[model samples]
Target: MQGFLKVFGHPNPKNPIGYGIDSVFPQLIADAQCLHIVAGRGFACTILIATTSKGAIYFGRLLLGLSNGFLVTFSNIYVSEVAPAYLRGVLVALVSPWVSMGAILGAAIDNATKTRVDKSCYQLPTACLYIVPVLLSVGLFFVPESPRYLLFQRYEAKAKQSLVRVRGELSNQ
Candidate 1:
């Protein structure tokens, strides 16, 4: 399914809607975090409504997929660009392990709630999805944009500021 979606993931050469989305969003981290928050909320809502209807569950899955597509793509690019060269491979590799940890944590939460007779069973598990995005949104405020992005956009001063924030005093290097 993900492989099939990758086809659409590529920016259309003729329309370039995806390119515009990528370029126009000045704050990539914040925007990606926002996408996570919305996706989390959408998943929670979908699960809640899913108790009543099949259609709502399907719709929620669709929304979750869309938001996740954007979040993963943007976050990966942003992280790769922002990370220092020495740590770039380690940081990128960490993404998969973190995803695995999330899966484990989610399974633990589901296991704990599985015995409940009421709606709390699903609600509790679904609510756990909010934790990462909520924390990420707050953390992003402390993070600087990718220096490369700033440089590419021709904001040399801001790029330097971002580099200083990430690399800590370039010192004529």
Candidate 2:
């Protein structure tokens, strides 16, 4: 639902970064990171639920929902824009497998920690979630903004740079 809403929403015109996916991608990634952090903290706080409330668990769910939504939507857009035409279909198809891989890993972690009676069971799984955001943040730093997005905004120089980063030299063809 959040993804559906974002599709129709206009980018902030006042943003110095300009508009469209170029502007929105970075923000979405950052929001995902923030949400991940919130979820992690919420999960960690669950340790205190004996004295506190079960509300922390719900808060984590809320953060996870928002985080996963943004990641799913923008990741599709980013992959579509960045992948070469011939490879685009295959690349997009891989997303499902990757998602499954994450689920599998999470399940493995849960199975491994399920026997614990203390906070470690949940805490260990929650701590593992932090790895996704950390790796994503680092990875995003090395990735160029989508050339197609830059072109749409008339940033020709930046678009060229982005293209070169992704595709190597621009052929005369």
Candidate 3:
């Protein structure tokens, strides 16, 4: 298993500088995930406003694609790693429904704006995209780091504290 992980780069390649900024700031991955989402929404909003400029819209869309790819991959990883063991499956399963809800909301917005002849048609829907990422970015600040990540970094006390925070009091359990 260790050999397979090494071959596949499961833990990622070692940096000569000792993990660089990540070592100094443990929340780098989470911050990056939030950044990608916020930036993606920014691109979407920009694309909507650039109705006359096909090139600008196309470039914005390309950036959106890159941001969304990173956002989805990192979000899933973050959720799975951070969730408590007993609730892991439930938390992971909720991801699909959460995504579906966003689609449903977007569709409803599109339906409402379908009759508009002005730029408001796409602009309203695009503007709505900002809500989720903004809320998510703010929400991330309240959550603790993944216990596994803390443990891997040899921060046992912090890992235990994280588990306690996520799982709640031992007496309740």
Best by lDDT: 3
Whole-structure CA lDDT of model 1: 0.70
Candidate that beats the other on TM-score, 2 or 3, i.e. the better one: 3
Q: Write the per-residue lDDT of candidate 3 for residues 1-173, one digit (tens) a residue.
A: 34533453335446432332334354675567677677676767677566668787787777767776767777788788877678778987887898789899999999999999998898888788778777877887787787888887667888888878977755643
Which model is ahead, 1 or 3, in terms of TM-score?
3
Tally clashing residue pairs in candidate 1.
0
Clashes within 3 Å, all models in order: 0, 0, 0
The alpha-carbon deviation from the true structure for residue 7 of candidate 1, after best TM-score superposition, in angstroms, is 30
Alpha-carbon TM-score of each model against the true structure: 0.74, 0.72, 0.76
Ten residues in sequence with the least summed lDDT for candidate 2: 44-53
After TM-score superposition, the amount by which residue 101's alpha carbon in candidate 1 deviates from its true location, in angstroms, is 0.4
Please, what are the lDDT tens digits per residue for candidate 2 over residues 66-92?
667767877888889988899999998
What's the distance in Å from true for residue 92, model 2? 1.2
